[model samples]
Structure formats: structure tokens, C-alpha cells
Target chain A: MKAIEIDNLSKSYNKGKVQALSSVSFEVERGELFGLIGPDGAGKTTLFRLLTTLLSPDAGRATVDGYDIVKEYHAIRSRVGYMPGRFSLYPDLSVEENLQFFAALFGVNVEESYDLIAPIYKQIEPFRTRRAGKLSGGMKQKLALSCALIHRPSILFLDEPTTGVDAVSRSEFWDMLAGLKERGITILVSTPYMDEASRCDRIALCNEGRILGIDTPHDIVRGFDNRLYGISAKNMFTLLERARAMEGVVECYPFGQRHHLVADDSFSVEQFTRQLSDIEGLEIASAEPTIEDMFIKLMKR
Target chain B: MNSEIVISVRELTKRFGDFTAVDRISFDVHRGEIFGFLGANGAGKTTAMRMLCGLSYPTAGSGSVAGFDVMREGEKIKRHIGYMSQRFSLYNDLTVWENMRLFAGIYGLNRRETEERASALLKRLNFEAERDTLVGSLPLGWKQKLSFAIATIHRPEVVFLDEPTGGVDPVTRRQFWELIYEAASEGTTIFVTTHYMDEAEYCSRVSIMVDGEVRALDTPARLKQQFAAESMDEVFRTLARGAQRGE
Candidate 1:
């Protein structure tokens, strides 16, 4: 079953000065962990806003759980859970109070929905008395997740769920989402982190208010048709400039401490290393291309 | 405990009207090191950072930044450090190179240094061809990259980046941090705030902020060990729960 569907979706703000989304379309299957990968102003949030019925599209339409996004807005709201990127919860309320309030607002009692959030809520249960604003980033994220899941909506929309937390919190949050998915919840998450693309079941690499490409993470990386090499040296900057200028080199951008150089022509590691070594203080080694590489190459075309 | 520390705060506090935005917090940033400041929303990360950056004054206690007393030398600190906000702060009307030149003038860089550094920075960002391209015409990631380059063009002693990689793609983020590393190598201390956990792993040391307090400060690996987490994300969740330490 298609959990969510968007068709001919277009939206704009400021009397057309801002084209937030444009003729976008896609479908997410049941129980799929679909990711909308893009940077700021790529219409990811705009799409989320439209899907959640927070805003109406100037053109196009969408559906959540077989209900029209516009006509059945209230029904859709109750049937789907959403966690916006920002911490929008009331800071004055305690952790438990926030959870209870959200539960009541959704017309669900904590006792009935407790099982769904057992894992995450358990960790934060002790901090139940702490004010929502006083809790840590990771804790607030968990609290928000639990609140979103309290009603057990079949579809979930998480807009940049891991944006501002520590690395550990980010990982744990994904884990909780995975667990939620296993319980038959279809997940649609948007993130700016390309490395996070692989964790999704399928991804749509988006930019400039358009969807560039949509495919499985493995397929995206496999689509990178070039020999990638990592090079470093005493004079990394000078070596980078020279490598970028090398013959048959397509792209030479710094990756971590090493320069991830993509060859325009297929070249052996030895030849690549030798070509780099000719530049004083240059060092090189074979390397693999990441999702970011695939996204940039696809964007170029 | 070293007197050479670039930043030292003793029981610093901040309030807005009736709300205590930053609770009493204390931490010292070294003279030359990449210090990662992280927190969830409303965790007092922004308030704490504002106090350190001289954008907001503390309500209580005192501190020092870069040898100048933070309480009385806020102006001196601003001249010696570059700040890049999470949102783009550059002039959209100006070209990429023009923005750099404008910021260069703000730092009092001579015409020669401004021109030379603008060219160098644009080249490093792979936007040399777009030197004349209006900042508004560029993508968010590109704008963010250029902002960082321009911020550091003045070659300040420190750079304060508040959520620099918030909405940027991973590839852009990787390049952004490289520039930061280059600046650090040149002996410029980096006091960066971010929500991206992986970025925390790259910092020489990280401090997790919550409720206006420094909850955790250490190497990523050490925090991982302390939290029994295999990755930075797990470490963050574990600590974020304020889970009692087994030891």
C-alpha cells in the first residue's frame, strides 16, 4: 500500500517571489523508511508542511493513508504523526506533562499508547519532572518522538530529526525510528546529512526545489562511474591544486584530511599515485566514493 | 587550568527579562583548539555562545576571551574573531567576491589583502568563476561555504560558527570543516556550535550543552567509551538521558 502520495505539487510564497516547491511528485510504500535528502530551501520542509496540512499548496495535491490532504485535513492530521525540525514543544511544561498534553490533544491516553513509546520513554521517564526546556537535546528529541508516536499514526513525518543533536543521539534516534517502522509505521524523513542517506530504505536526492534522482542508497553509490582515489601530503593545498589540474581528473575535492580525486578516465592506482607523487609533497591512495560524491555528480548534469 | 586558555568563565549566567536563559555555567576554551559546542534546541547553547561571543552580556559572574576580559573587552574580542551564523549573514546584493571584500574591510584588511584573500578564498571554494555572481543566485551550501571563507579572510585569532552545517549537505560540510582545520593549523582557535553529531567526532574536543551547563566535555572517543556507545549518536543519547554512570 502507498502510505503517502504527492502529485503535481507546486507551492510559492511572497506572491511568487519564493518558489518553495515545483511540480514535485513521489510515492512512499507501506513501512518504507523513505528519505527526502536535500539542503535548505530545497522544498523538503515545504512538502512536509503541505503533507501535514499546515499549509495548502497553490497547485497540485497529496494524500496520506488514502485520505486527501486538503479535504480530509483533520482526519489526516490525526492519522499521521509529525515531528518538525525545531523544538516546538511548550518549554514551561514538564517532560511528562508535555507527553500527557500531546496525548490529550491527540485524544489518546498515555496508558493505551504507552507500549509504542516504551523503549524511548523509558530512558526519559526519570526526567518526567524536568521542564521541557530544561531537558537536553537528545532527551527532547526522544520526548518529541514519543509524543508523535503516542497516537500510533500509520505514517510518520520527521523533518531533519537529527539536525542539532550529538552524534550518539542522532544514531539512537534513527534506531528508535527503525523500531517504530518495524511496528508497521511508514516513515518519511528528510535530512541534510548525505552519509545518512544509506540508512534509508530508498532516497530521493533533491535540490533547487526539484527531485534530482530517487533510488536505493546502494544503487546511488553504484551509479558513481569513476575511479576514486584519496591523496594527502606535506603540502596538501598545493597537492590538491595540482591534482585538480591533473589530466583526466574529473573532480579533486578534499575529503577529510585526504583529497578524494575522481578520474575522468579509468586509471590504475599505481599510475594515479605516480601522477600525484610527481608533485612535490604529494601522496595518494585508492578510495571509494560516498553518497555525497554521487549527489554532486548527479547535480552537475 | 592553564592561564593561557583563550576563554575562561566563572559561574556565568544570562537572563532575558524574567527567564534565566543561561544557567550558571563554566568552561575554558584553550588558545588554539577546535572546541565543539553542542546542544538540543532551548538547551541554552545559544545563550551560552552569545555570552562568549560578546553578542550578549552575562547576567552574573565574569570571564575572559583571547587575553581580553570578556566582561570589559567584548569589543576587543569582536575585532579578533570572525562569526558565521547558521543563517546566511552575507549581503545577498553583493557578488561572492564582493561579500568577501566587504567583510575584509570590516576587519580592516588593506585593499591588497582584501583583493588577494578574496581571490584565494573563492578559488579554494571552487567558485572563482562565479566571483561576480550575486550571493542570492548561489545555492544555500555555496552561500554557506563562501560565508565561512569570508569570515576567516580577516585571519582572526578565533572563529565562532553557530550551527555552520545545519542545513548544508554532507559533502559541503566535509569541505567546510577542512577550511576550519586549515585555519586551526594556522593557529586560529575554532569555537564551533553544531547539531550534527558526526561533526562533533571531528572536533579536537567537544562540550555538550544542556540547560545552560556544560554537561559533557571530552574527545568524541572518550565520550563514546564513557557512554558505552559505539557511535557518537548513541553516546549523545546515552548522555542526553543523563543516564547514571555505571562506574
Candidate 2:
């Protein structure tokens, strides 16, 4: 059975001045890890909110575990775990208390759900007496996840769960989510980080409330038809300017220290480098394209 | 990497009632380098930055930012350092130039100096044309770039960016980092926090915080090698588990 199914889902805010979601429709296979990838104002959060039934959609419909999103809102809330982008685990309660409260809210006890959160709980267990407000961003995130999972929901909706987290904490957080996937819970996570998209089983590229593309990370990159050349110079700004100025350079944008340049029909990497080397105080090198590169290309297209 | 340390922190701790937001952490931020300070949302990084910036007093610790003691000379530290918080800290009613001017006035920059600095920053950030655009009217990415510009209005020795690239697009983030690099090249120290591991790669060095403590601090390359991870994301995960194991 499909874990999630949404058809022509559309939502807006500010009296329709802001269209939060426009015909966002997709399906999450049972036990699959799905990512909603986009930048700010890209409707990622809105979509997540709608899926969780925090906000009613202006048009269309969605279902979690085949339960109607609007009519079965209460049922959906119980069957699905949602950790919002912000840290909302009760601030006054201790780590354990917050988890217990959430478990109770779902008509379960911490003992009944403790196994689900054991790996993460152990880290913050020592600080179980510590107030949620006092916990670190990473800890709060973990706590939120634990609360979401207390009910052993059929599906999980994590809205940018790894955002605003340390690199190490983010790494651990994804691992935890990956572990959760083993139990066959469909996970729908949205993140602003393009790199995180690859870790998902599949991803929907969103921009300005529109679904730009949806496919597995590898498939999306494979679909990119452009020839990519990565180039770097002593000065990034000058290199960018030169690439933009270069003949037949389709897209010249900085990826890191180096810049990735997509070529037109006539543009060649060797020839492009040869011309770029003539520029003073520049270091040019070839590079591989990442998911960020793919998104840049898609956005441009 | 320098003889003169821009910031020297020792045994930094912050407590709200019984909670330890920052638990006796310490680190040194050198001059003229991009330093990445990373943590989760409530990891106390913001609290620590606030303490270092003199906006919040550390419950206990001894630190000097830009040669001014955080405890004794907090006002002086504020004057010598700039901070861009995670939230859009600028006034929405103000124009880009107006925000810059307001910050300049607070930082004690002269009118001519403020104009020269604001114009230069705006030009570098490619928002010179949008200088008159109301900050509220601008997009999320533009506002982020503008906030960074205003934070450093006084040309402080060290600038703190609390997740400066939180929700902006990749293209704008790249542009913002260019500004940071330029500032670093010109002898300014950048202390930034970000969730994007790719952004962490650009820093000369990065430190990961877990539960109000520095879990790992080193160059991104070194951390990656030590963790035996292909990317920063894995490095973070491996270290988080290690921290969990250690505890």
C-alpha cells in the first residue's frame, strides 16, 4: 500500500497573495525515504505542514496511509509522526518528561516506545533531568524525533529536521532516520540542504511552490543533459566574471573554491580552460558536478 | 594561525535556572580566518555567540574578544565585533542603506566611513541597485546578504554569523560566502554557523557542538579523514555517535 498519496495539492496564505503550494502531487512508497528539496519560500515547509494537517490546503487533497487528510485529520495525526522545522518539544519539561508527555499524548507510555528512541535517548538520557529549553539544538532535534516516533506511526513527516544543526549532529540525525526506515515507516523529510537530497530514497525538487522535478537523486543527476565543467581561479569573483563573459558558457556559477560551468553545443572543456588560463592571477581546474549543480541547472531551465 | 588571538575563551558556561546552555566550553578564534562554529538549533551556540558579542553575560567564564574581556569590557567587545543573528535582525521599515546607517551609528562609525563601507559592501554583494529596496520587500536571499553587510558595518575585527545562510538558495549562499571570503582576505575574522555541510567545507576550520559542548574542532579535511567519512555529513554522524558512546 502507498504510504502517502496527494493529488493536485495546492495551498496559499496572505489571502492568496502567497501561493505556498501549487499542484504539489506525489506518492511515497511504503518504507521509502522521500525528500522534499528546495530553498526558502520554496513551499517545502508548507507542503510538510499540509501533509501533517497543521494547515488546510486551499485546493486538492492528500492522504497519509490512505486516511483522508482533512476528514480524517485526527486519525492522520495519530498514525503519522511530524517533527516541525522548529524545535517545539516542550521547553519546561525535561528530556524524558517531554518524551513521556508526547508518548502519552498518543496514548502510549515511554516504556512502550522507549526502544524506538533508545539510540538517541541514550545520548540525552544522562540529561534526562535537563530541561528541554536547556538542551542543545542537536538534543532538542533528537527529542523531537523521539516524541514523533513514540506512537510508532506508519509514516513520519520531518520538516527540515537536520537544519540549523552542527555537522556531526546532522550526520547522526540522518542515521537515526535511516534506522527508522528499517521498520518500514514511510519517511517524508524536507530540507533546504541540497546534499541531503541524495541520502533520501527519492526527492521532489521544489521552487516557489512549484514542483520542478521529482526522481531519485541519481536519476535526477543522470537526467541532466548539459556538459559540466568545473573551474577555479586565484580569485573566485574574477573567475565568475570571466566565465560569464566567456563565449558559449551556459551557466557559470561558484560551487566551492572552484566554479562549475555548463557548456553550450560548441563549448569544450579543454578549449574553455585554454582560454581561461590566459587570464592573470587565476587557477583553473576540472571538477565533478554535485546535486547542487543539478539543482542550479534545473532552476535555470 | 596568528600570534595575536582575536578571541580567547575559557570555561564558558551559561545557565538558565538549572539548565546549562553552555557547559564550560573554551576555544580560540584567530585573526583573519573563516571559523565555522556549528551546533544544532538549541545547542547553545547562539547563547555562546551572544555572550562573546556582549549581548548576554556568561554565567561563568573568562574570555577576551578582540583584546577586550567579555566580562569586563563587554561594551568594548561589542564595538570591536559584529554579529548577524539567525533571525532577520534588521528593521523591516528601514531601507538597505538606512539599516546600514543605523548599525553604523550604533557602532560609532562616522558618516563618511559608514557611507564608504556601506557602498563598498553593497557593491560587492551585488545589491547596490537594491539599496533603496525595503528590506521587507526583498527576497529571503537578498535580506540575508543585506543583514551580513549591516552586521559588519563597523568593520569589526571578528564578525559572528549565526546560521547566516539558514534558508537562502544555493546561488545566493555562494554569493554571500564570496563576501565573507573577501572580508577575511581584508583582515576580518568570520565566525559562522550553518547546517549546510558544503558551507562547512569552505571554512578554514570547523567545530561541532553537541548538547552545549564542543564535540569536535578541526579543519574540515582533518575531521573527514579522522572520521573515515566521504563527506562532512558522515563525519558529523560518526562523531555524534562517538560522543554518544563516550558519554
Candidate 3:
């Protein structure tokens, strides 16, 4: 049986006026690191809540660890670990106390799962006596992850774990997740950062109550339908405006050091090169689409 | 790059009790420059920004923003700078038009000026239809764009945007950058912070803070070359990985 399975799941709020999730469906294999990639309010959290059995779906059904989500919620709760996007840990409690309290609630001793959470917990163990609220953003993140894993859950669900985290800490957090996956634990993580999609074994690109696509990061990039070009000039702002105004240009958006420009078959590189030759420090090269590029295209469709 | 300096700091420091949040950081931002201030969490980026914005006073050192002293002329500094953060800066309960009026009034604009600016802003954003709608009801992307627009409504000499595009989609993120460029083009210096490395590359110059100090500051190309890295992300990781103080 799959670690998680959902069929036609839908949810709404404010008396059906707000649709948070719309007929979302997917599955996660045991021990696989799955990613739910999307921006804020993309229904990532809504789906997690439904699968974790915190809330009932408005339609359809789901199961986790071979148990019905609604009918066997108690079984799933004890079996799966959930780390909410917010800092839900007790702010007043010390790091050690918080971990102990969570472990006790799940009827397990800290020693029982020390091996499972030691790698993360040990980094924060020096500050075990510190209040959870007093910890820094990165330290707090580490503490939260330790607590979520203290119960030795078979599956882990992390919601936007790196939303406001810095680049360095964000990279470290992914490395921790990768470590957990290697220990035969199935992890379902969500993040708003597109670059993180590459870290997951498979990802579901979600947006505004819908899933845009589901595939490996590499395959998704390969699925891009257009020939993209990266163009950069002294004045990027003016370049964006001019590129978009040029004939045959389908799309143009800033990507890091250069602007990713997509043009139709009618686009003549030789002719455009002559037209743009006068611009100072101009460089244009064939570019490969990233997951972010594919995501924008999917949203447009 | 030759524009007049709008923000200048030397040996700027902020300390609380035994902890030093910002320690002797110094830099200069030119007029109309999009200066990217970046760092790991708890690396003093916020503390330094607060000092510059006149929200918090520094414990030591000297600085000036928009030609006003950071320590003695905080009120003047506040008047000449605009600020917008992803977490706060908007009135969710108020309609789009009402929020505009509120901010404009606070910025000391006259009724006639508020009306004119509000209509022009709405039209430029093609958001005239949503003028009466409450800001809370709009999508996150729309709300973020509106917040930036309102932050610059007074045409301040410098605008500080704190992670203004944190969780927006790719397309909307680009749109936000377009707005930043537009504001800079009009001579509104942009002092922005973001975790997005790509956004870092967009800036004319960037400063990466580590352990309560400005460790690296240069143009994106120069920084990349100096660090021998292909992208800003690598440079950031190289500098931030050694940070001992992280929250």
C-alpha cells in the first residue's frame, strides 16, 4: 500500500465562497521524498490538513498508511509526523522540555527515537535549556524538526518549512530532510522556493487550489515547450520592455543575471541582433528552462 | 554609479544588553540605486535597516539617510524614506482606495493630491475596478503590488522593501521587480532585502551581512568574480556558511 493516497479531494471555506483546494489527487510512495511546490495560498497547506486528517475534505476521500483518513484518523495521527508552517511549538517551553512533552504525548520516550532525531537534535542540544521563543530563526527550525521526529513517525509532513528561512539555512534544512529520507522514512515537504523542487524525488506543482503538473524536477524542465533565450544588457528594465515589444516575442521575464525571453518561430536572431547591436554590453544566449520557468508556463495555460 | 550618495553609514553599531546585533557595519548607497541588503537570519540585517529607517536608534557610530543624521535627525529621516515589509504595512480591513487615502494622509498629502494620486495609481495598475474592494479580499500577489505602490506614493528619496516578494509566483515576482526598477528610474533609491539570489543579481550592488557585520559588499558581477562563483547564490553560501550567530 502507498504511504498516502487521495482521490478527488476538494475543500472550501467561507460558506463555499473561497475554494482552498479543488479536486486534488496524488500519491506518495513509502520512503520517497515528495515535494508540494507552490507559492502562498496555493492549497499546499489545505491538502496537508486533509491528508493528516486535521480537517475533512468537502468531497472525495483519502488514506494514509493504508488507513482511511477520516475513519482511521487516530491511527494516522500517531503514525505520521506533521510540522506546520508556523512555529507551533510551545514558545514558553525550553527546547528539551518541548521535545520531551511531544514524545510523551505520542507515548514514546526521547531515548526511544534518539537515533531518529539525534542528528538534528544534537545541533540544538547545547541550547536545550533555552526557551523555544528565544531561539533564532534557524535554531527554532532545527528544534521544530527534532520535535516532529522525536516520535519516530513513519511519515513526515512539513509545510513550507523554508518559507522565510535564509538561503544558507534553507540549504541546510533540505540536507536534513534528505538525511531523514535515507533512513527509510517517507517525507512530504512543501516550500514556496522553486529551487528546492530539485531536491525532491517527485513534486506536485500547486497553485490557487489546483495542481499544475506532477513530475521530477528534471522532467518538468524538459517539458518546457518553447525555445528560451537569455538576454542581458546594461539596462535590464529597458531591455525587458523592448524585448516584449519586439515582434515574435512570446514571453520575457527577468531570471537572475539575465532576462529569459521566449520567441516564436518568426523570431529572426540575425535580424534582431542587428537591431540590438547598438545596445551596450548586450549578451544573448540559448537558455534552458528551470522548474520556475515551467511553472510560469503552466500558470499561463 | 556616479549619483550623489543618499545613505551613508560608518561604524554603525547596535547593541542590546550583552548582545551586539549590528556591529560596525558601513556602506554608501547612491541616489536611484537598487541596493540589495542580504544576510542569514539574525545576522543584523534588520537591526541595521531599523537604524537607517529611523525606527530604532543605534548604540554607536554615525550614519545619515537622505542627507539627515540617523541619530539626531530620525524624524527627518523617516519623512524622507518609505518602508514596506511582507508581514506588515497594509490595512487589510480597509478598501484599496481607503488605504491609499490613509497612507497619503499620513504622508501629509492634501485631499486633492490623494484623489489624483489614487486614481492614477489604480489606472496604471489596471486595478480601477478593485478600488472599492477590501485589501484582505485580494490575492496575495495583488496585495503585495498595491503595498509597494502605496509605499512609494509620496515619492520618497529612498524606499526600503523587506522581502516584498517572499511567496509570490514567478510572474508576479518579476512584476514586482519591474515596479522596483520603475521607482528607481524616477530617482527613488531602493534599499531592499530578499532571500532570492536571483533578485540579488538584479541589484546594482549588494551587501551580505554575517555575524553582525557587513562581510561582503559589491556589484553582483564583481562579487561573483571576487568569490570565484558563477552566481550570487554560491557567494552567499560561501559567506553565510561561516556565520556563528544565527537565529
Candidate 3: stretches off by over 4 Å: none
Fnat: each model in turn: 0.41, 0.62, 0.89
Error of 2 at B143 (Å): 0.9
**Candidate 3 lDDT score relative to the true structure:** 0.92
Q: Positional deviation of A79 in candidate 1, in angstroms?
A: 0.8
Residues B1-247 of candidate 3 have per-residue lDDT tens digits of 6569999999999999999999999999999899999999989998899999999999999989999999889888888888999785689999999999999999998999999988988998889999999999999999999999899878799999999999998889999899899889878899999999999999999999999999999999999999999999999999999998766
Instruction: Give lDDT per model, in order.
Output: 0.81, 0.82, 0.92
lDDT of 1 by residue, A75-170 (tens): 899998999999889999999999999999998899998989999899989989999998877788889988888998999999999875545456
Where does the lowest 10-residue lDDT sum fall in candidate 3 chain A? A268-277
Cα miss at B13, model 1 (Å)? 14
TM-score of chain B of 3: 0.97
Q: What value of lDDT does candidate 1 attain over all alpha carbons?
A: 0.81
TM-score of chain B of each: 0.90, 0.91, 0.97
Model 3 per-residue lDDT tens digits across residues A230-283: 999999888888888777789899999999988888887777777878777778
Candidate 1 runs further than 4 Å off = A266-268, A278-281, B1-75, B87-138, B153-155, B174-247
- Which has the better lDDT: candidate 1, or candidate 3? 3
